[model samples]
Target: MARLDESARGVYLIAVTPFTETGALDLDGCDRMADFYLEAGATGLTLLGVMGEAPKLTTDESATIVNRVLKRVDGRVPIVVGVSSPGFAQMQALTGRVMDDGAAGVMIAPPGSLRTDDQIAGYYEQAAEMIGDVPFVLQDFPLTTGVQMSVPVIARIIKDIPTCVCLKHEDWPGLAKITALRKEGATARRVSILCGNGGVFLPEEMERGADGAMTGFAYPEMMTGVVENHAKGDMERARDLFDAYLPLARFEQQPGLGLAIRKYVLYRRGVLANPTLRKPGAALDPLSRAEVDRLMARLEKRLKELN
Candidate 1:
């Protein structure tokens, strides 16, 4: 693989990995979702992300998904593959596969279960050194990852590996902290920061100086419009776009709703054969599906209002 195009534009959509009715990976569904986002102006595809149910996927499944997506994309858009697991060797192996498959970079969460600050830092330091020339985002998603990478840890990793690039900080107060870090008189060339919460807080993060969004653009109808319009210098339109999606976004916080709802919407949009989820992360049931339909109906009204 040659040098993939580096993401100069900071905003990215953490895409949902659609699945077939038979519980298989849905390549066609993934392609439609990618095209939807890219057409809406997303900068890149952040796949195998927590939003895409990375933890549930086996290492082989993860590698195959990356390869399939890379072949489908054919370099039209850069790929950001998230490798979050307790297994260091697994993370390293996934990173290698992603880099080899022409991904733009890898996003890594803290190592192992019950990782302390030092252990996390050490993991990042070692992982960066091992990854060599590839760029990776240090993703701090404590809600699921069981550990949060702190500011000092963030500072250390970037200082150690300039190629470490940036962070997908899921820490709430992180936006202000990152702003302070950048605004407080220190600078690094290769480092960048991105917003990771599903595009709901983009305006707020932008106000706090977030480099761009790393997640939540999967729904091309509303969220992607906000990120793209905002990037293109239309703040008013961005706010309107975000406001229109807030009612639906309210459910995005519900445990597992993000994936199930996203997959549901893809199914509705004819992007997926069916929303078949793996164990421990089952697809929306009748009740959940009903709620998704209601929310999407409201979202359709909102879309009409926008029009």
Candidate 2:
């Protein structure tokens, strides 16, 4: 059993929730994707993060995915469930629901459907009050949330809730501000700054002494190699792998094509049923499909070359 306070061991993969052709939750695909990451040697899984289509998923649906993932993993790895909503009450309720259903940790994005520091703080404050003893990882993806979680805001959260053990760092260069917050390395070990925004920024963040990342679902090798090997003085091979994967990783984060490309690649590789997602997720049109296919073909050829 994963205790709420159990320290995260290494870089975890943030899974992309898969769907079937008719927009049904692809439970089997979900299991296969999670298994792929674990077998690739990922430390744990940060489920329903920004990439899991959290904003688009219903609370009950999100809980169901977590429950299914829990069964599939069977305590082999910790599952950090993201249970965020627009308001504090909803966040608390969702957290309670997930915890009651047996999630290991509740990762929350900043307040949604609004844009103000006080509003954000109030949401989080109420969230802390509502969900005691639940471990929280503050998310800072402004693209997902309307506002950035500034240093002062984070400091406020830390002051109020010491159990907020991690901050999923997707802020552009917030690491610099974060590094400045170190009072005898308070920023380093006191709280974990998980590398979000894909593993692209991970090398730089690790170089600057940021903790591990909740990198993408498909490519656990990239983060695992960097953390376990590169961070541990195996720079030579790490550089080689990083160089080879840079293009593919860059393509993975391209606006609009992100999910479509990942699903297409997984489909081509025969791991996914199809390149499908829940509605309002913006699937590829003809032009977008052409772009995805081009990039995927390059990635596929490159993978074979590496072999």
Candidate 3:
């Protein structure tokens, strides 16, 4: 198994699941996307995320996608798969299969039913046991999971679960959480903290002690540049590059419309051949596409000025 640890730091792009115009899984596109992300400076790839249309995939389809991504990735970089299921059995099975398929780790978000801190902590304890030593990422994105883990609660989970290695930190206004976790004596062990609000909060998050980012913005090179610049102590350059991409990043962060915009940008950049989304997904309308086109045009101009 590919093990993800605190030493892991950089852009881990949450990949999009592609489909044919007829709604069939685009396995070819998966291979292409894996290669594209790596070449674009992504240190890792996260699959089966919410933006990946995970729930729409059947068990067999999920396995096939994981297998295909691992095969294409071919051990170049770590792969993390989301295994946040309602049942432990399903989570266990998916985690096992993906780990067996060469995944580095699994990401788990608390189920919506979890209310109190005890319920959240207990669920992770049970999940850690079920997964049996597979390193996992605690996805603390409240907007999607509806489970808000306070700082103390997160520290408690880290203290108790040795296998909880990294956090996909997407809590809005989450800089304080990063600060709390990175603060001295917050926890016995320190784990990697990667922000995931579509890279909108990345500059401030990095400034607040986040390791890096793990969001699926269409242009991952933007994230790579920001993280690298920050690590080099070039705060001015990092902020400049981040500002250059901020408009599109903000535009792409729109909830219901974001995925469509991202897929279209990927398609326009030739990373994907088609922008077809699976059923029940939002597709880009003419006006939306035009808006994305304008954003891309302005992004090009701004990037040129920065360069």
Candidate 4:
């Protein structure tokens, strides 16, 4: 597989880790999930992300999932595994293992302990040194990580780290940041910027110079539709497709319940055999499930009307 680089684009779905009803790793379900993402028009896959329940898994379990999905994907598209850990040793170890196992690249999110600008910049310098030539996605998700990366700081990192090839832009109200980073001479080199936050701001982000999305929205076709149409200079068509999925996208953005909603929808769509999340996770109640069903029905009706 080709290494992920600045030229990367399109929807890179942050894949969910599938589990059985007993919460065991579902290797078969992983294969089914990989097929579903590719069939839905994903250009790449990001596994072991926060959405993939990374911290909950043991090292062996994480490797098992990565290898399973890599074999299933068979180098069809670039696969980026999140290797954010409290220690650089673990991150380096995981990066080496996955890269050896055919992964294209890895993602690193700043730990919440990082506060000062120098601290943030120094951390990436250390990380890049530790990983040693492995291309990495700098995940700038302030809401989840509580580590705010200013545009100047981001530009500095991109300028300083040659191996930092992409930015996972997940900061809320971050469209301006994208514009800033894209300005001429903002950095030594331009890195691919893929927006997150479930892709709710993808249309605006693209307009602000984002390459595409790296989110876990269950209805990925909506994301692919938006990106494709936007690239074709069809803003109206892009927004029309986005509006159709907005309601469910908003519903799934709810904190603590988002993953459950996504898993349930995937299961209902026959992408997963079970909607089970591992322990220390939340599941939707009966009423919430029914509400999701209603939203899905409405989405179907809206899509049909659009067609």
Per-model TM-score versus the true fold: 0.89, 0.89, 0.98, 0.99
Error of 4 at 271 (Å): 0.6
Better of 1 and 2 by lDDT: 2
Residue ranges of candidate 3 with Cα displaced over 4 Å? none
Clashing pairs in 4: none
**Highest TM-score among the candidates is held by which one?**
4
Top of the candidates by lDDT: 4
Candidates by TM-score, descending order: 4, 3, 1, 2
Q: Superposing all C-alpha atoms, what RMSD in Å does each candidate have to the true structure?
A: 2.5, 2.6, 1.0, 0.6
Kindly give the number of clashing pairs for every candidate.
0, 0, 0, 0
lDDT of 4 by residue, 79-130 (tens): 9999999999999888899999999999999999999999999999999999
What pairs collide in candidate 1? none
Cα lDDT tens digits, model 1, 1-307, are: 3442324455677877777666677777777777777777766778888778787788998988888778877887778888766666777788888888788888877754645767877777777776677778878777776686666767777777667776776776566676665666444443566777666677777766666778763365565566566668898998998888877776766666677777677778776677667666756679887887888888888889889
Error of 2 at 44 (Å): 1.1
- Ordered list by lDDT, greatest first: 4, 3, 2, 1
- Candidate 2: list runs displaced more than 4 Å: 4-6, 112-119, 182-189, 285-307
